[model samples]
Target: PLAIQQTISVYLIAYAAMSIVHGPLSDAIGRRSVILGGMLVFTLASVGCALATDLPTLLAFRAVQGLSAGAGQIVGRAAIRDLFHGDDAQRLMSQVAMIFGIAPAIAPLVGGWILGWAEWPVIFWFLTAFSGLLLLATWSWFPETHPPDRRVPLAMRSLVRDYVAIFLNPRFQRLAAASSFNFAGMFLYIASAPVLVMQHLHLGERDFGWLFIPTIGGMVVGAYLSGRAAGRMSGDALTRIGFVVGGIGALIHVAYAALADPFAIPWAVLPLFLTGVGVALIFPILTLAILDMYPRQRGSASSLQAFTSLVVAALVSGAMSPWLSHSTLYLALGSASLTLLGWAFWRWERNVCQRLPACPQETTAVEPADPL
Candidate 1:
């Protein structure tokens, strides 16, 4: 079990760590090429995993797959920013979120179905086929989102300078941190799923859907609402609404954790629905803000944004979740803390944007984001 856990963690670690590289690579080249290359590598790595005879070989292939898997998402995000802006971008992003939300809830079930008919290697075979399909689709249909004129040189010095400048910029850090902390709220539950399902809810292994289905359902709804509200609502308005809804959900979770006689389904899982909705609403807007900050280097910005969230999630999984998973109250506290802190960061950024001359003029010009 421990070995299996290590293998899983290693994949995630590689995914997060390699994100910084992929983002810049996309900027230097183009979104279509980078995405195709990543899919090709991932497909080959999946084939390698399927053929591997030893655990170490499997792990190596898994790492390669992980390193390549994130390219689509990160580059795809930059592509969205590349092609669209303002309400159009937000609407597209929300729709993307709506569709993407289904994958996590259904992927495990798909894996189970594959396993029932064949061995574990069959799962890798499926991934190989899937990525191969994606590679072909990208090659045939995906237009180059990043233009050659807009691309930055991939020189080592320029790469270091761009990263350093982005990281050092206070507004960029704040926006990225806001996104990271907001995501950590739901991630706490994800990382503590074992304790949450088996210990608190007394659910069997197969019953995990009880928690995920409702949460993802709410996310779909929220993403839908966000798409509808994109032009009508300011980015700040959406964020504030999200925090309020998320706070209410956290309070409900804490109340149940404290007041319920025995932890059970529906009640134990109800708060997650609202939290998921809140997260969905906030994600696209914050993501856009980060990307908008560095229009020319949107790929690098997307990479750093993802890296921030992934690193924080990895830490929560490694350190925070362990300490909080012992009790429902602790988990509630963890969730609430992330939400409140994320809100704080957003508030601080809002204030700084109002006061700072360096703040991007287009942020306010395009959307009139509330100072809150």
Candidate 2:
């Protein structure tokens, strides 16, 4: 168990750190090339992982795999921002999230089945083939989103300057905080899943789906609704609604943990469903807001955004979760606390937006544009 935890956290740590590099590199070069190169690296690393006979070898390949994992997600976010604005962007983000949501719901089931027929190395082999196929598809079809005219030069001086500029911006920090901490609220539960299922709910390893399936289902629903709401609701309004819904879910979970002795299924996991809905609702809007902050530096901006969230998740998984996993109430309180932190950041961003002269004054919902 400890080895598994260590290996998982290490992958995430490597991923978080490398996100900072991949985003800027994509900005300096082009999205398609960076993505293609990353995919190639990932595919090869997956093969290495499959062939590894020792733990250290496996871990090294895992780290290599993590290094390439951020490329697609970061570049894809940049592409959406590059192609569209406002509601068009929101709808596209929601749609993408909805499609992507299927993987988490199905992955554990697939893994369990794989273990039934073969050893764990087969999992890596499956990943290798999947990534290889994706590489080919991307190579063939993925157009260059970042044009030559818009490309930033890759230089150490400029890299430091850009990173510093992003970090120093109070508004950027506030917005990023809102997105990252909100995710942390749900991630606390995810990080503590072993305790949640085994100790609290008295379930076996395969029962992860009990918690994940409904949660992911809710996310898909929320993403669909968010896509539909694009032209009808202002981003601020949608964000506020999401926070309120998430707060309610967090409170419900906390209250149940306070009262219920042995947490019951369906009921115990229900709050997670609501929280997932809130997550999908707010994610696209917050993500786009951060990217929009530095339109010219969208890749860099996406990098910072991914780095912040990944780092926060890593800490929560490695530090906060172990401490809080002792009891259901503690876990619930931890999640609630994170949610409140996110809400506070949102409030601060709202105030900052009101005052900043250059801040977009999006009083009305944006009208939908033709899907490109």
Candidate 3:
């Protein structure tokens, strides 16, 4: 169990560290090159993971895989911001999120099927094939959304300056915190899946679908609703609705955890559905808002936001999951706390925006001051 948790944490740590670089690199070169390069590296790492014979070797390869895996998500976000704006961007983001939500539900089922027939290495082989396919698809279809004219030079000093500027901005901090904590509230459950499924629910490895399917299903529905609500509702209004739904889910989860006698399947997992809906609804809004803050440096903005979330995820997986997995009530309380933190951050951002002479949401880009 410790080894399993470590494996997950190491990947997330490497992923979080590299995320800071992936965004700026994409901003310097082009989204296409960075994504293609990362995919190629990820494919090779998957091969290494398959061949690894020992835990250390597997950890090494997993770290390598993590290093490369973040390029696509971070750079892809920048690409979306580059091509679209306003409601169009929100709709597309929600649509992409809806599709992406399916992966978590599908991966465990696929892995279980593979393990039933073959050994653990075959799973890595499957990942290799999947990443290889993605690489090919990207090479064939992905475009260079960031033109040379808009590209920032790859200078260490300037990169540091830009990072510092984005990180220190009050609005960026609030929005990133909101997004990260919101996701973390649910990710706590995901990271704790083994304990929740096997130990608490008394289910086997194959029964993971009971937990993931409904959660991701709710995410899909929420994403669909967010897409539908794009132009009709304001971002603030949408975000508020998302928080309300998520808060209710957290409270209900806490109530059930405290009251339930056995902690069974359908009932234990139902609140996660609401949490998923809330997360999906708020994610695209906060993401687009951050990207809009730095129009010319969307990649950088995306990277920082991803890094924030990944850091929180790593901590949750490594530390929180281990501590909280022992009790359903503990996990429920942790989730609720995270949700409250996210809502507080969102409220802070709103208050700050109200006080500003120009709303950050309306501003397309705030150009960085020259470090020199």
The number of the candidate with the highest lDDT is: 3
| Model 2 weakest lDDT span, ten residues long | 363-372
- lDDT by residue for model 1 over 142-259, one digit each (tens)? 8999999777667666776677777877787788888789878887887787678888888765566777777787788889989999878888888889888888998999999988
Off by over 4 Å in 3: 99-106, 354-358, 361-372
lDDT of 2 by residue, 256-326 (tens): 99999778898888998888888888888888887777777788888988899888888898899999999
State the lDDT at 341 in candidate 1. Answer: 89
Give the Cα error of residue 160 in candidate 2, in Å.
0.7
Count of steric clashes across candidates, in order: 0, 0, 0
Ranking by lDDT: 3, 2, 1
Off by over 4 Å in 2: 99-106, 354-372
In model 3, residue pairs whose N, Cα or C atoms come closer than 3 Å (at least 3 residues apart or on different chains), thus clashing, are none
Candidate 1: regions farther than 4 A off: 99-102, 112-118, 354-372
TM-score for all predictions? 0.92, 0.92, 0.94
Best by TM-score: 3
The stretch of ten residues in a row with the least summed lDDT in candidate 1 is: 363-372
